[model samples]
Target: MQDALIVLVHGAGIGAVFALIGMSFNVVFNSSGILNFAQGNMLVLGGLFAFLVLPSSPGIGPWFVFLPASALLMAALLAVQGYLTLLPLRSSVEQHSWLITTLAASVIIGAVLLIFQGTAQQTVRSPFPSFWFLGTRVPAPYALSLLLALVWFGLLRWFHTRALTGLAISAIAQDLDAARAAGIRVHRLQILAFAISGLIVGSAGFVAAPVIAIANDSGVSYVLHGFVAAVIGGLGSDLGALVGGLLVGMISMYAAYTYGGEFQDAVSLALLVAVLMGRPEGLFGRPAARRV
Candidate 1:
């Protein structure tokens, strides 16, 4: 029972990170109809930033400063990337240019990280102390990651429902052409969405860095699992991302416990395949309608 509880906590913590990445994907996809593949790399970059800027032993004050600074920096960078990615095409959905553009951006970011950070896995000592939970020594970062996920989810929900700009962003997601016709600045909103995505994943990466291995190549795995979570939850649903992330996290953890660590990815892949076969639209995703 204690073992199970430990797995649960660890799974939820790591799952929260995946959920943040999934939410980032949804944000970009919704606003621009383009999946900013660079998002995963951006998360890695966030951790790298934390590694570079943060002291070996940081206190709560350092984290408070790090969070907003990381968000702003990521937002600016992603917004610029979004602009470049969207500049060549009139309609993002109609043209497939983003596939290449975003991927190229991702590659460039990864390359840069590799050049500077190298292949060694980096880990920072957590400023917060570990606590015992039901005979398990639980790390503080795990609980903090889960808390951040829930807080971000609530904040996003409020933004979508209450904020005018967020409502406009949602309008663009629903019908780009209609939103443009309604005088909404679609392109601007798309850029904002990318920035918002950066804010989400960037802060997440920083907070969760203590638990996860930070390395240049780690982006690929993070993105892959995050994409799986997003697909499982439905592409545009934030709530779905949360649920999917937790589900994926728990399943993978359980698989590791039962079959061994190597089987974690395999189990996640199997779950993804099952979801695709049984419900392609995802648990919370509505079927998209097309006018022929």
Candidate 2:
């Protein structure tokens, strides 16, 4: 029973991180129709920013101070990258230029980190102190990650329903041509999406620092994991991201416990393959319809 509880708590924390990554992917895709393969690296950038901004002793001050700072920095940096990636290709004939451009941006970020920070892994201490729960030791960071995920989800839902800019984003996602014809600024909204995505994912990385170690090349693997979660949840569905993240997180934790840590990736791959083969549109994704 204790083992089961442990897995549950552990899986919930992991799910929170995956959910954040998946939602960030969904935001960029919905706004710009671009997958922004650099999503994971953006999280890495957030951690690095927090590392640089905070004093060596992080728990000494109000941790909330660093949160917005990292988030805003991430928002600015990623918005610029999004602009460069999208603006020039506004009239390009090639439909998939984003594939190369986003990947290139990711590579550049990784290279920059390597050149300056070296290949060593950096740790970010959690601001919250540890606590005991259900007769188990639960790190404050893990619990905080879960709380933040819920809050972020609610905030996003409200933004989509009540905010004018959010409505514009939804309109664009539904039909870009119609939205533009209606006098909506498509490019600007897309850039805003990128900025918002950065803020969310950057904060996720920052809060998750205590649990996940940061390294220059860690972004690629995270991208894959997050991508899998997004696919499972349906690429553009925010609700799907939440459910899918939790599902994937639990699956990963269980697999690691039952078989071994080595089987974690293998299990995830198999699940992804099964989903693609059976329901390419994903569990929540709507099947694409075209005029005959």
Candidate 3:
């Protein structure tokens, strides 16, 4: 019973992280129908950036100062990359083209991180303290991840409800042609969505790396799991992405707990396969209508 409860808590924590990541990916997928393969790279990039900007590292300023600084700077830089790389693709262009382009971008960004950061697996000293709940030990970074998710979701819910820009972006995602007809600047919205999505994904790196050690290839699994989370949750629903990520996270965490840690990847993939085959539309998503 104790082991079960611990498994649950740890799984839930991991799920929370993946949930946020899925939300970030879902935003871009829903907005532009682009897979944004580079999302994982953005996370790794942010992690590497954190390594560079920390006080103990080769950077200036206090550790506290560098955290936010690195976060904001990385987000901004990725936003610019979002603008430059994705904004130009016409919404009418084939999604495959965008997929290829973005996949290439992911490779490029990942390679760059590897080139600079090397293949070392390293840990980041977090600004938060670790805690235990019901005999389940929790890392500070995971706790921080939960807090970030709450704040980000709260802000997103609020913005979507009240902010014109946020609503416009959501509207564009919902009905691009209708949004255009209503005088929403589709191009600008796309640009904005890319930037915001990049920023969100970048922050995933910022917070998550402290919980798990980061490496040159750290991003591949982070992103692959994120895709599973987003797909299983629902490609079109933000809430679905959150739920999906959490589900995937829990599966991997519990699998590793009960089984061997080495089986984590295979278990995660198997779950993804099972979910995809069982329910393609996902838990909260609506199935597409068949053409007559």
Best TM-score among the predictions, by candidate number: 1
Q: What's the ranking of the predictions by TM-score, best on top? A: 1, 2, 3
Measured by lDDT, the strongest candidate is 1
- Which pairs of residues collide in candidate 3? none
The order by descending lDDT is: 1, 2, 3
lDDT of 2 by residue, 1-292 (tens): 8887788788878787888888888888987778888878888887777677666667646478888878888889889988988877763223778889999998998899899999998877766777988767888877877887788788888888799999999988888878889999988888899999988888988888767757789999778888888898888887777777877887888899889999988888788889889998887888867558
For all candidates in order, the CA lDDT equals 0.88, 0.82, 0.71
Please list the residue runs of candidate 1 whose C-alpha ends up more than 4 Å from where it truly belongs after superposition.
Answer: none
lDDT of 1: 0.88
TM-scores across all candidates? Answer: 0.97, 0.94, 0.88
**Over all chains combined, what TM-score does candidate 2 have?**
0.94
Q: What TM-score does candidate 1 get on C-alpha atoms?
A: 0.97
Once superposed on the true structure, which residue ranges of model 2 sit more than 4 Å away at CA? 91-94
Global lDDT of model 3: 0.71
Count of clashing pairs, candidate 2: 0
